[model samples]
Target: MVALSFISLVGCEASVATHPVSGKVVLADGSPVGGGIIKFRTKSDEGETVKAHGQIQPDGSFQLTTFQDGDGALEGEHEAILFSPATGDGHNAVAAPNFPTKYRKYETSGLKFQVGPGENDFVIQLGTR
Candidate 1:
């Protein structure tokens, strides 16, 4: 049938297939960091653009869902990027409501990681560059 053929064709392609990515973002002080960007990048063994994107969450928690056929992300060397709540683009962001105003030290620059297929638990500890 056409539906079966379409599914077969989709399975033949290599892409970020269906999967789930879950993790937590925190500061070096073991405190939760809220409101920032998290970027995931993967490079194939053949130097191909595997996958890349920036996911943002108000809290230090995230879950990336990959779909079937078109959602299975390639497994390989991966990197991550995390922005802090205290500093953004050198503008010197203010402290979060959970912390004191003087404690403006939760923002982070770029984070890195290695990703594979399956559930992944991550903790991002942001430090000054």
Candidate 2:
């Protein structure tokens, strides 16, 4: 049974603690983004970074998941990046940009949030600039 005990310990050690994270993505006019992705990346004090991702729904609502579905993200400071695929024409159609190009990259998005030990509900606002 020694091997079984060791396996259990390994499994426990591989799990990371996470908290629930949910939010809405809206424009300056308070309109929903429709469809897209939202990513939350954190720079940890231990020099390791963790990332969580959520898909924006039709109503612009989203629930973040890190290791599992709706499991949320690690508690820390995070940089949020919003990506909305162009929607318009059909096949052979050019895709238009939704938010500003700067918001697509985590380094330049300028959107920051703090995930606490409990539930985190945020409202992300996108601007023209």
Best by lDDT: 2
Task: Tell how far residue 75 is off in model 2, in angstroms.
Answer: 0.4
Residues 1-129 of candidate 2 have per-residue lDDT tens digits of 999999886685357678999999888889877677889999655677778999888888999998779999888889989887656568665443366778899989999998999889999888743
User: What TM-score should be assigned to candidate 1?
Assistant: 0.54
lDDT of 2: 0.83
lDDT of 2 at 25: 84
Candidate number with greatest TM-score = 2
lDDT of 1 by residue, 81-107 (tens): 544344545576654334332223222
Superposed model 1: Cα runs more than 4 Å off? 1-19, 65-73, 83-110
Q: In lDDT terms, how accurate is model 1?
A: 0.53
User: TM-score for all predictions?
Assistant: 0.54, 0.77
Q: Give the worst 10-residue stretch by lDDT in candidate 1.
A: 100-109
lDDT accuracy of residue 29 in candidate 2 = 89
